[model samples]
Target chain A: MYELIKNLGTWLTSGSSWTGTDGIAHRLAEHLQYSLLATLVAAAIGLPIGLLIGHTGKGAFIAINLASFGRALPTVGLVVLVFLAGGLSMLPVYVALVALAVPAIVTNTYAGMTAVDPDVKDAARGQGMRGHQVLFQVELPLALPLIMTGLRLALIQVVATATIAAYVSFGGLGRYVFDGLAQRDLVQVLGGAVLVAVIAVTLDLALSGLQRFLFRHRTA
Target chain B: MTIDWSWIGDHTDDLTTLTVSHLQAALSAVFFGVLISLPLAVVAHRIRPLRGFLLGVSNILFTIPSIAIFVLLLPISGLTRTTTVIGLTVYTLVVLLRNTVEGLDSVPAKTKEAAKAMGTRPLRTLLTVEFPLALPVIMAGVRIATVMSISLVSVATYIGDGGLGQLFTDGFQRDFPTPVIAGVVLTILLAVVADAALVALQYVLTPWKRRRA
Candidate 1:
């Protein structure tokens, strides 16, 4: 165990591993690229639909069912299927990641919007706020915390799934893991796992902090 | 990229075996998950100060990806099925513990008081009254955990024990789409079936809910 830890420490701190084309820096960038692009596209698609159904209180059945269906999807299956169908490119990674992410965003957004007090909406309307105005100013603000929660959940899940991108010959922190496994290099594998865990925990903490801030701002 | 229908046709036995393996992994994880989570949730519900800390630990555990968890356990569990089950069970803890506690909290104070008035022991009241009333919420958690476990088991392929996820890795390596498609379809089907079965179980277990409806 001591020797293994020493090897891991050496692998993680090695200057060569920190630089060059195949380095941790480049791989981490690629991983974030996949995660962020997919999340942005998902937010573009999911947010509008979620807000629409949530604001109008229609098609909620479809939204909820869609979210559940997304949850049941196997990320590995989807990623590999898309890779096979779409050919080896970044597209499949994005497609699979986006598909995985949209559900949490949609469901949470809808839940947040709907959970806004009916009395608050009534007051906004009575104040002569237009429908769109009320939705934008009153509903959206109140829904920020839940919406952030959804985004946080989506981002975390995407980061995890994005690790599988390396299996398809893409670049990311997962490259270390898959490559380490292939070579039976436990040190590299442990290092990769630690990095991924760090990213996930850091992201969760940052988002949770933001969520708490939003919640506090609202109450104040 | 097209699926080879003929390949699927020749693989029925293999498919069935893989499906069974998949279900066994997922189900056992959920079983042990419930065993561990139920006690934690009970304590969390009964003691107000401990709830946040317990849930927070599970939340952090849940953030770690399934692949990472499996790999992290490799040194200790040596890439065995034990690693898969343990990792998956840890993943289920967040949902199960949170939902069970919420379910227990949903039981009305008045009902618990009435049970206590009848000289019922705390444990007995919990088993007979609170647990029964909490069944619906707890079952919802079970459904979510079942689906989650089913999907996550596919990622266990990298660890050499993903069950149906084997088909995915095979097809990916062979650059064939048939097994991958089959794996995807079957996984989704298994999750849906498991969820539906749980729904039915909840209905049967909560007869009072049915009577009211």
Candidate 2:
């Protein structure tokens, strides 16, 4: 155990590990790039659909089923299937990650929007607010917490699966784990896994903090 | 992409074996997750200060990615089925504990007081009165955890222990889409089936809820 820790410490602190194409810096950048792109795309697709169904209260069955179906699809299968079908390109990774993320965003956004008090919405409407105005000014603000929750969940899942992109010969922090396994280097594997965990936890904390901040007024 | 029906027909036995193992791993993890979480949730419910701390820990555990958690356990548990099961159980604990705690909280205080007035012991009250009332919420948690475990077991393939996930790695190495499609379809099928079963179980267990609905 002691030796494992020492080796991991050395691997993490080694100057070579922080520089060059294979460095942690480069890998982290790739991880964030894939995660960000997939999330933005998922948000673009999910947000409008979620808001639409949530505001109009129609097509909920389809949206709910879509969420559950997306949840059931394994990340690895999606990536490999897309990779094989789409050829050897990063597009497959983005596609898989985006697919993985959309359901959470859509579900949470819809839930958030629908959770808004009907009376509150009615009050806004009674004050001569238009449909879009009520949705935008009232529903959106109240639903921001759940929407952010969905975004947070999607981003975290994307970051995690972004490592799988490395499995398909793309660039990301997952390269370390796969490369380490191939070479039987426990330090690299552990170091890489630790880094991924750290990033995930940091992101979770930041987002949760933001969620709290956004809803500070709501004791519930 | 076109699916090879003949390929699936030829691999029925292999698919069945993999599916069985996949379900075994996911179900066992969920079983253990509920077993462990129920006690912790009960204790957390009783101890007000401990509730936040326990929930926070589980939240952190949930935040750790599936692949990362599996790999993190590799050195300690090795690349075995045990490692996969343990990693999955950890993931389930997050949801199970939270939901269990929330379920316990949702129990009506008036019900507990009425039980006390009827001379029920605290333990008896908890087991009889509180638990039955909390079943719906707790069952919801179980359903989510079960589906999550089924999907997450695929990540165990990286550690050499995925059940149906093996089909995915097989297809990838062979550059064939048949097994991959099979794995995806079977996994989703298994998850949906499990979720449906839980919903049924909840319905049967909460007849009062059904009547009210």
Candidate 3:
């Protein structure tokens, strides 16, 4: 255990310098930025579609099947597909990550909307609330918790998968892991693993906090 | 290059063989995962402190990238079926263990108390009462783990394990769209069919859900 700790420490500090072309910190930051941008793009598109489909309740099966297909599509495969289609660099990575995030966001959004208490919706409608007004005023607020849950799940997945973008020489933290493996450096490999684990746990905790905050606000 | 359906049609046998291999890897991983996680979950549930530690470890494991895990394990397991199965099994623990604990915990306290009042042994009570009640949630976790393993197994192709990922890698290497598209389509189909089968199994195992369905 002590040896393990020492190795981990050495790896984390060894990669501290960013003077080289492929600095771990620089790669991490770039990967994170790409992941965040991709997730935001996915949420922007997914949330609206989720809301529209969820509101109409007409295409639930199709929406769900599409999302399931999205989830099943491997990130690496998608990245390869995008690359084959003349998309390389960060664009393919972004597209793949967005594709991955969409299903969760869409599913959760639809579920959250549909799960809104029927009585509250009916009461809002009875009180001269237009369809749009009820959705905006009541449904969206109530569904915020679930929607946030979906966002949280999507965020973690995006961050974890962004490492795969390194395979295309896009220079993400996955470079550390893959390159380390190629070079047979356990220290470097462990460092990359530690960085990813930290990001995932931190994001998860932060999102849990956000979920709690949304739930509390909804009740209050 | 123009798409060639004829070439793919001729290679349907190859596709079927690859699908079989993929299913073998996923099932082996899920089988071992459930075997290990169930007992550990039961033991952890009985001991509160151990439960927290187990859950923490599993949660940490959950965050590790599947490819990274495979890469790390390959040196020790030597690019064999053992590496892929072990890596995927570890991944399943993060999902299965949590669900098992949650499922058991969700069993109503009153049900357990009544069983004890009838002089049922602790083990017997757990098997007879708690296990049945928790079957649905446990099955749900198993379903998720199965799907996850299937998807992650594609990455195992990097370590010389052949599956649908072979198609993807081969396609990429040769710049052939047919194999890549075929691999993607097959993977999606596998996931959907597996998901549907699990849903059916869940229905069979938990008859109460049938009413809801």
Candidate 4:
């Protein structure tokens, strides 16, 4: 363990490791691009579908079952499958990561929207609010906490899965771990593991804080 | 770039072997996860402090990416199924434990009181009443964990212990799409099949819930 930590220190401190095309910064950028693109795409697709289904109380079956189905489709398998079909590029990785992410967002959005107090929604309607206004102004705010929760879950999963994109010869922090494993370099493997963990932790904490911010209105 | 159907068809034996291996690795994790989590969940449900600690630990474990967990364990267990299963089991613990506690907690207080008022022993009341009532929700958690384990076992291929994941790696290396596509479909099917079976089991166990009002 000491030896592993020492190697990681070497990897972290070395100038070459931190710069150039194959450097940590480059890999970090690659990881972030995949994660951000996947998250954006998933949110764009999931939030709308979730809000629509959730508001109407329609397609509950699809919303609920989609979560399990997404969970079941192995992310790695999906990555490989897309790579085979779409060619060997980061697009396959993005598609796979997006698939992993969308379900959580959808399910949470549905649940959050559904869980809003009916009286509150009825009041919004009983007032002069139009349908879209009621949905956007009242329901969305009420459901923000849960929606944020879903986003947080999806983001973490995407970040985690993006690491494995390295397996397909894509650039990411996972490349460090896999490349290290190939060469029997424990330092590289641990360095990559630590970096991914840091990303996951930071992302989760940020989302949790956002969830709290969204939630503040609830009790107030 | 295109699939070779004949290649996949000729590999039926290989497919079955891989499927069973995947099932074995994943299911064993779920089985032991339940065994380990149920008791802890049961006790934790009634004890608020313990509940938080258990959930906190499991949640932290859950955050560790699947492949990271496997790689983290590689040093300790050295690329064996032991490391893979342990990693898988850790992932299942949070899901199972939370579901178990939630299901048990959802059982009506009145029902427990009624069981006790009937002169039933506490342990028997818990076994016959609380557990049966909790089974449906608990099964839901089991379904999630099982599906997750099945999906994750494919990632375990990195450590040389992939179940259907081996097909994925092999297909990629050999420049063949057949095994890769087959592995993807089979993994998804395994998840769906397990979920359906669990749903059926839940219905069987919770006949009261099935009755019309």
Candidate 5:
């Protein structure tokens, strides 16, 4: 344990490791790029459909089934499949990340929207509100917490899964991990692992804080 | 740019071998995951104070990306099936443990009281009344775990013991699309089949709920 920590400390503190194109900054940026792009795309696709289904109470069965099936689809398997079809490209990585993130967002959005108090929505409609007005003004505000939860979950999953891009010879924090593994550099491997864990934890904490804030704001 | 579907046909034997082993590994993980989680979940439920900590640990475990789990386990178990299985099992623990605790918790309050009033011991009540009631929920968790483990088992190839994941790594290494597509297909197929069977099992187990509905 001491050895692992010492090595990790050394790898982390080394001046050369923190700068330039091959450094931690660049890789972290790459990691964020994949995760954020996937998240945005998934939100674009999942949020509206989830909103419609939750609002109109239509096509939920198919949406639920598709989301569940999405849960079953393996991230690494999809990454590999796309990587093969596309051949050592960023396209597969982004596609895999998007596929991996979509289900959580869709499911959570639908659940959140459906969970909103119908009487509250009814009041909004009773106040001369249109369909879109009731949805955005009432349902959307109420569903924000769960929707955020879904986005948080999806983002965390994407960030973690993005590490696999290194496995496929793509550039990211995973390069530190996969390359370190290949070279038998335990320090580098653990360092990379710790960094990825840090990213996940940081994002989780931030999202949780956001959700809590939303909850407070909603209740107040 | 093409799948070379013929290549898949040509490698039927290899594909079958990978699929079966993948299923075995994932199933073994789920088995061990349930075994470990059942007691821990029960303990957490009964203890009350420990509930938060147990769930927190499991959540943290779940959050640690799958690759990191396998790699972290490598020092202890090395690049072996033991590591891969342990990694997969740990991943399933959070899902199953949370499900188990929630399932038991969801058992009706009156049902417990009835069992107790009937002179049933705590353990007996748990066994006879609470557990049966919780089966549907717990089984759903198991279904989730099974499919998730199947999905995650693809990353276990780094430990050199993964089933279909080996095909993916091999395909990527060889720059061939056939094995990659085959592996993805087989993994998804196993997940769907296992999930469908579990859903069926849940339906069979919850006949009372169905009748009420």
Candidate 6:
């Protein structure tokens, strides 16, 4: 056990820590940039679609089904599909992440909008608030919490699934985990896994904090 | 690149076999997950400290990458049905445990008091009052777990385990889009069906939610 601890300690302090230049950190950053971009793009597209579907109140079933279908498309499978379709670069990764992020955002946005207090909406309209004004001032603020919940879910998923980009040589922390497995390097593999868990938990906490900050008034 | 319909047509048997296997794995995982989580949730509920510890542990487990779990388990257990089931079951724990606790907690205090006032035994009250009230939330957790298990089963292909994942890995290696597409399509279909069935079950179990609807 002491030997085991010693080895682990050495692995942690080794010069070749996965985050060294040309290593895990650089790769992770690249993947994160792409994943974040994809998720943001997905939020841009999905949030509006969700809001529209919720407002019209006619296409709830369709919107929900579409989102479910989006979730059903496994990230890795989508990546392979894009790879086969002659787009093997980060484009495939980005597209897959975007696709994966859509369902949660859309579902949450719709739910959040519809859940706004009917009385508040009516009051806004009674006060001569225009449709757009009511939406921005009354609906959006009320719905923001749920919308943020969806975004948080999407962000966590994007971070978790972005590791799959390693399969396409896009070089994320997944490289360390997968390559470590290939080489039977438990230290590296465990380290990478630990990093991912840490990242996910940290992001979750940060989002929870942000959600509290944004929705404090409502909760209060 | 043109789409290949003929290839998909030719591999229908293989596709069906893979889908069946994938469904089998997911169902088994969910079964075991519910089995383990329900008891654990009950224990945690009875013991507040245990509840906090287990909840944190499960949350940590939930964030651990599915691939990492697959990799870590494969060598220890070897690539077998047991490994896949165990890994997926652990994955479902976070969802199932939370849902179970939430479900049980959702039962009204007045309802429990009524049961007690009627001189119902502890076990009887749990079965007739608590469990029944918690069923909807529990079912919702099961729905989520089932979907998660289905998706993770596909990732299990990395270890040469389970059916649909086999199709995915094979299709990727051979550059055959047919099996891959078939596997993805079937997986999606299964998720939709499962989700709808669970929603229906939730409605049946909690008529109040239905009335609200």
Model 5 TM-score? 0.95
Clashes of 3: 0
Tens-place lDDT per residue, model 4, B17-85, is: 999999999999999999999899988998898998999888777877888888888778988989889
Give the lDDT of residue B136 in candidate 1.
84
TM-score of the B chain in each candidate versus the native B chain: 0.99, 0.97, 0.94, 0.95, 0.95, 0.92
Tens digits of lDDT, candidate 6, A1-220: 4554466577666767655655656866875786689889999989999888766677999887776577567677778777767656788788888888999899999999999888999899999999888888888888889998899888887887787787777677777777776787766666666666668778887888988986777653
Q: Candidate 1 regions off by >4 Å?
A: none
Model 1, range A1-220, lDDT digits (tens) per residue? 8899899889888899889879999988988888889999999999999999999999999998888789888888888888888887988888889999999999999999999999999999999999999999999998988898999999998987788889889899999999999999998998899889889899999989977876874662
Q: Which residue pairs collide in model 1, if any?
A: none
lDDT of 3: 0.83
**How does each model score on TM-score?**
0.98, 0.98, 0.87, 0.94, 0.95, 0.88
Query: Could you tell which candidate, 1 or 3, scores higher by TM-score?
Result: 1
Candidate 5 residue-wise lDDT, B27-92, digit = tens: 999999999999999999899999999998898888888888888887788888888889999989
Question: What's the CA RMSD of model 6 in angstroms?
Answer: 3.1
| Cα-based lDDT at residue A58, candidate 5 | 94
Off by over 4 Å in 3: A1-8, A182-187, A210-220, B5-14, B43-56, B105-114, B206-213
Tell me the DockQ of each model, to 2 decimals.
0.84, 0.82, 0.50, 0.67, 0.67, 0.48
Query: Clash pairs of candidate 2?
Result: none
* Model 3 per-residue lDDT tens digits across residues A43-67: 9999999998877778999887877
Q: Which candidate has the highest DockQ of all? A: 1
- Looking at candidate 1 chain B, the ten consecutive residues that score lowest on lDDT are B1-10
What is the DockQ score, from 0 to 1, of model 6?
A: 0.48
In angstroms, give how far residue A7 of model 5 lies from its true place. Answer: 1.8
Off by over 4 Å in 2: none
Give lDDT: candidate 5, residue B176: 81
